[model samples]
Each structure stands twice: as structure tokens, then as C-alpha cells.
Target: MKLYEYEAKEIASRYGIPVPRGKLARTPDEAYIVASELGSTVIKAQVLVGGRGLAGGVKIAQTPWEAREAAFKLLESSIRGVKVNIVLVEEKICVSRELYLSLTIDRAMRKPVFLVSEMGGVEIEDLARKYPGKVHRIHVDPEVGYSDYMSRIALSALNLPWSSLSELSSIMKSMYRIMVEYDAELVEFNPLAYSCEGKLIALDAKIIIDDNSLPRHPDLQELYGRELTSYEKKARELGFSYVELDGDIGVISNGAGLTMATMDSILFYGGKPANFLDIGGGASRERVREAVKLMLNHPRTRVLLVNIFGGITRCDEVALGIIEALKEVSQVKPIVVRMLGTNEEEGRRILLEQGISVFVEMDDAVKTAVNLTLK
Candidate 1:
């Protein structure tokens, strides 16, 4: 699950990463109080999604009254459609240079990789995309763990000042530690700035923890109760891995890898995925039913795509779940099923009996589902 900027910064501080002096405020009066203490503050809307600044969710305040005005404006607004009830009131930093640093799993290599960009900030993506040579990537072997040299080497190639090497390396190591300690999918420090005072500080923080690993971290569970979307909370309660998206096709698969592949297949076929729902290994008929019902209930899901390469999960069970879910939900969205592996024939027969055609080829099923969306 994605964390708010303040929460990510709090975790960074615990790891010895320097972050701006800040506090969360829910009211304009609280913002005024915090700004008075900190002076020259930045008021940022607390939202899970990105592009908050572009959405006018971030504002600078030179005075306490301005801080109150900034907080009032943000708290009354929505950032990328998510309501902002809280704002991070932080002391403004005068930066000499802005840098980007992040660590995330490189699925292709099955290892963790650190990405660094000298030309960082809001335009980092565009800079790296248009000029790939500006971004330096450092891959760390998961078994060996991270060392100081990994970041140092990447920074050296960017021609970063030698004086700041030690501090920047320390920050990078802390970021790696945070990712491992919290089972995070991503830990990012955008604008890991070198301040005018000759110190490094994280101006912005974003951490995405693996939702499946939340069970192991009870302390992080408290964030979910208030932070997660309604559909996300429901999916968690049902024990299915789910992520909401902005598209028309809702995807369901038995494994995380397959679920991702299904979404990719949809995209390749010119279809957008509305959500990712992994029923997980050995999914029961009830879980499948719940997954189907969940997708059908989503207003954005115009079509359902169920791709099952069943093993521990039987195909018959998947078919049974779909049938059961259809009975429970009144939403009449089109469902496309592609079943293979254990009990494949039985599953196909069950769906066929109900006048639903099952596809043997995943490509054909995906294509049919994409086509159905146009109708």
C-alpha cells in the first residue's frame, strides 16, 4: 500500500535519514501554530496518490496567516480526487541542488535496484525519459545486502561534489534499510536536496509497502484503517490482493505474477485494466466468488477477465465461484474466462452449461474481453 508523504518521512527519520522539520495538521489553526513555530513553512495536502503539487495541493506560506490560508485552501480541496483531511506543515529548505534517489524491486532481474538522477525534481521522469543517460541505476544483490559503495559509485559517475559523497551514501543506505525492514515495494526521496547549510535533506518522501506483507507488521496496520480506499479495505478483508486503477476491464488471476501478466496482456490488446485482483494460491470457491462480486460491484469495471492457470486452485472451483458470484450480484457486465491446468475440462463444462464460453487460449480470451468493452 502507498503511504502519505509525512508517514514516509517519519519512517525515513527513524532510519537516520534527514527530513524537513514538520508536523501534520488537520486544521488551519493547527497549521498556523506549526508555522509560527517553524517559520516560512510549506503546507502540503496529505494524499496517497502522486502529482499533489501539480493539483495545487502544495503551497508555500511566508507567514503564520499565510500558513493558515494555505492549509484552509488545501484541506477544502481534493488532490487527484482523493480527499485531503490532513496537511504536512514543514519548514522550507533553501536547496543548493536537487537530486532523486529511489530503491525498488527490479522484477526482470529478480533483484533490488537503486535509481539515481542528478536532474531530479518534478521533471525527473521527463528528464530521464528524454535523456536516459542522465539517470544512473545501481543494482544490489539481495543475498549480499547493500553497501556504501553502491551509491557512491552511481553518484561519482554523475559528477556529484566529492564533499557530499559520504552523507549521500549514508542516506542511500538508510533508504535501502527502510525498504528491507518494512517490506516496502518502493522507497523514494524526490528532491533529496543539498541545502544551503551544507546538509542533505529529503524534501519529499514516498514509500509503497507490499500489501501482502502487512500481516507481518502490526504497527503499519493502523495506517490502513484510515488511509486505504473503500475497495482496498474490502479486498484486504476478503484476503485477496487488490489494487484499484482507472480503466474498464477488471482482472482476476490466481497468482500475483499471473495477475500482472493478465493486465499486461490486456494493455497489449488495447484494453485498460480497472483493477488487479489476485485470489492467491489455492483459492477456494468462496474467495473466487468474492473476487468476482468485488469486481462486478466496481462502477468502473465494464468487463471482467478471469485468467486461471490453476494448480493448487482447481478450475472447477473457479467456475463455481463465477457462477455463484453472478447469482449474488445484479451487475450485468461481460465476463471472459480462460481456464487451464487442474480440472480444466470440468471447469469449462460447468461454465459452458451456464451459457458462458470458456477460451483455451489466453490471447483469444483477452481479445474477446477487450472487444466486449467497446460494445
Candidate 2:
């Protein structure tokens, strides 16, 4: 689960990290009010996705009028297909230098890694590729946890002034604590700026909590619930996983691994997936109906692709669900289905009877779905 920038900064502030004063506004008038209070502010669209600046979602407003104008333009637009419903009006900072710092779970090493870079405000991946020597990484031992020594090792690599080391180390330790306490998968402070006043402050914040840890933290779960899209909320209620994408093809699969593979195949064949919907194990006919209905409801979905590699989930049962769904839903969007394993022949027969084409090959099914979108 990802928290909005304002939400992440709020969490960071609670952990003794310095952040520019900010308030979230839902309307141009509210943005004006917040901007007036701050005098000079940065109007930022509050979206979960990145590259907001490049998307024209982030702007500088020197006055209330400018703030209102920025808010109007942002709130009326979409970033990466996500509607900007709220904007963060924050006090603009005077920066002397920008730095990057973050803590993230390293799956391969099975430990949390702390990353720092002298350069900031750019994509870390690009930074590492262009100036590999500037980016530093340290793997924190879970058993011993983050220590002042480890903090020194990470910060020293940045070659920051000795005078800034103490405070920067404190901030790094605080961020580590927040990551651990909140069960976060990532806590990033991009462009952690050194202000003209010689103070290090977090200029941008991002926090992603582990989805599996939500049950243990009701407060974080509530925060996440508020940010979920309608389809995502419904998917959770129906015991499935869904992620919206910018594309015309809606993909439904029985397992996460297969679902991802199907999406990749679609892209490889010059297609884009509209969403990722995993029906998971033991999906009932009702669940399948719900899934299909959900996919058809997406305005961007030009076609639907169902790929099932049944093991515990019987292929015939999946076929029945799809048939029932088509009978109930009003949309006439094309659907391509691929079913293999466990009563595959029976499933194919059932689908054939309903005038639905079923494919035994995954690539063929993906290709058909992609072709339908072109029509």
C-alpha cells in the first residue's frame, strides 16, 4: 500500500523528521486558503504514482491566486489515469543542496537496505546508471537492527560536510525506526534538501507499507482504505487482487504468477493490459461473475482476456462462471479465454456451446484479445 506524499510527510514528521508545513486541499478555494497561510507554496497533486512534476501535477505558486490557478488545472486533470482529487499545498523551501535517502526491503538479500545518494530529485535508477560512484548502499542486519555506526557508514559515503553528519544521521535513524514500526516495504525521502538555513529537511516523502502486515496495523489499513479506487475496494471485498493500468485489454487469471505472465505476453504482442485481476484459488461461480462484471465496467477496457491454468480450480467450473457472467453483464466487449488442465476438454466444450472461442495455447489467447482491441 502506498501513501500519498502529504500522508508520508505527516508520518515522517511524527518521527522527528523535519518537513515543510503542508495541508491537503480538495478544492481551488481550499488551496487558495492554504497558500495564503503559507505565503509562497508548492502546489502538488496528491496521487500515488510518481513523475508528478513531469505530468504537470506539481507547480510553484508564489501567491494565493497562483495557488488557486495551479489547483484548478491539477484537480481537473489526471496523472497516469488517476484523477487528482486533492492537492498538497506546502511551504516552498529554499534549498542549498539536495540529497536522497531511503530504506527498502531487499528480497534477494532478505534484509532491509539503506540507500543514499549525494544527487537527488532525479530517478535513482537513472542516477545509479549515470553516476554509479555517487550512489551508496548498505544492507542492514535485521537481527541487530540499524545502528549509529551503520548510519555513519551510509552517510559518510555521501561526502556531506562533517557539520551536517550528526543531524543527517539522526534523521536517517528516525526514518529507519518509522520503517520498522510501520512495517513499511519502503520509506523514501527524495531530494532531502539542505535548506539555506543549514537545516536538512525532507522535501519529498514516499512510504509503502507491506500489504501482508495490514492486519496488524488497523490505523494504516484505514489510511489505505481511504486511498483505494472503487474497483480496488470491491476486489478486496470479493477476495481478489486488482490493479488498474493504462490500456484497453482487461486480464483475468487464476493465479498471480499466471496473471503477470499473461499481462507480459499481451505487452510483448503490442498490447496493453487495462488491469490485473487475480481470482486466486477456489474461485466460485459467483466470484467469476463478479470478476467479469468488474472488468467489463472499466471504461478503458476494449476487450477481456481470461487465462486459467487450473489445478485445484476446475476448468469446467471456470467456464460456467464466464458463461454466467456473459449472460448477466450488459457489455458486448470481446472475450478471449485460455483454459488448460483439470477437465479442460469439458470446459472447452461448454464454452464452444456458448459461441465462445477457447484456446489451449496462452499465446494464441493473448493474440486474439489484442486483435479484438484493434477492432
Model number with the top TM-score: 2
Score residue 109 of candidate 2 by CA lDDT.
Answer: 92
lDDT to native, each model = 0.88, 0.88
In model 2, the worst 10-residue window by lDDT is 151-160
Judged by lDDT against the true structure, how good is candidate 2?
0.88
Off by over 4 Å in 2: 27-37, 63-77, 225-229, 246-249, 267-272, 296-303, 367-375
Q: Which stretches of candidate 1 lie over 4 Å from their true place?
A: 103-114, 137-166, 169-173, 183-185, 210-215, 222-228, 245-251, 256-274, 281-283, 301-316, 332-375
| TM-score for each of the candidates | 0.79, 0.87
For model 2, residues 330-365, the per-residue Cα lDDT tens digits are: 889888989877777888899999889999899999
lDDT of 2 at 88: 94
Total clashes for model 1:
0
